[model samples]
Target: MGLLLSGVLVWQASNAAFVGVTSNANNSWSAGTVNLTNDSGGTPMFHVTQMVPGQSGSRCIEITSASSVPVDVKFYTDVTALPVDDIRPYIDITVEDGTGGTFASCAGFTPSGGTEFTGTLQNLTTTRTTYANGLGPWALDGTPPDKLSFRISWQFHADAPPVAQAGSTPNVAFIWEAQS
Candidate 1:
């Protein structure tokens, strides 16, 4: 009876979508609708590629928030040959608003009313040290690509319009670090 109960609990937990206070696929920003370009400053360097969701190569996601608080973002990858321990990867989430503005210029997207993730990307990016405990959610900072669940989100102003639309929406291009 004890063993059976334990197994059942483990199975149930795996099915639970909400983990680490961050949820998956909730308020998703449709791919291929985002606009890709160099930020106004142009000091920070990055690249973008167009890919259909669930198509060949890797699928990329861009999300915009309609809420006042910052939602923790996460990305889980398809099956891979390397173990989570041996790999190193990060995602550069260029969060934009409904009006097609970058996070930098958008004042309403500021993060609030959320606990700072202990291993959040902000800490890692500032420290500039690679190879932390194990592969978890980290902010994109142009590191070597690895098998990783790319997770990134930022707070958006409540009045911001929708950044992604269904079939005929304009999308943005961002470099998925997991790939070259």
Candidate 2:
């Protein structure tokens, strides 16, 4: 009996020694973020003074992504104040995707095929449209070079009726938003 007990004990010890061991390794994950900014130096992206009939003006605005992930970009405008004399109808505004331009100049800028928007400033301000979509999968440090430049142009129509009053839109706000 003693001998059998000893053999049993030895077999149990050997089986225990041969057993495999395992431990859990923990891990965690988090989602990235999306951010967009207007690269224009400061306020008043488009500022024109003394606009007259048959006269045109343009301004360049640069946009960049500082996102950690991919994002879609969109544009919006708000007419904070309108001309008191209702001169909006006589003004023609156009937006174009531009390249190789600075905020102060659109020299060497290549227009993206056609105009993105063409209408009176008052009308454009009421609507929010997609200026550029599916922009990029920008990295945290804005990798892949996610950048865009746009040109906003306006002209006082020569054929405008004589009744068009002399007025101005003092404040117009342009906004850029991003989504992942």
Give the number of the best model, judged by lDDT.
2
Candidate 2's residue-wise lDDT over 1-180, tens digit each? 999999999999878756678887887789886767776767687667776788888888877777777666666775655556666677788878756776767787888676778888767776653444322222234353577778888888888776674566647777767676
Off by over 4 Å in 2: 1-24, 129-144
- In model 2, state the lDDT of residue 63: 79
Model 2 accuracy (lDDT, Cα): 0.70
The models' CA-based lDDT, in order, is 0.30, 0.70
**Top of the candidates by TM-score:** 2
TM-score per candidate, in order?
0.18, 0.73
In candidate 1, what are the lDDT values of residues 33-103, reduced to their tens digit? Answer: 21122333433222323323322211222233222222222322222243333211122222221222242
Show where candidate 1 strays beyond 4 Å. Answer: 1-41, 45-104, 115-128, 131-180
The 10-residue segment with the lowest total lDDT in model 2 = 133-142
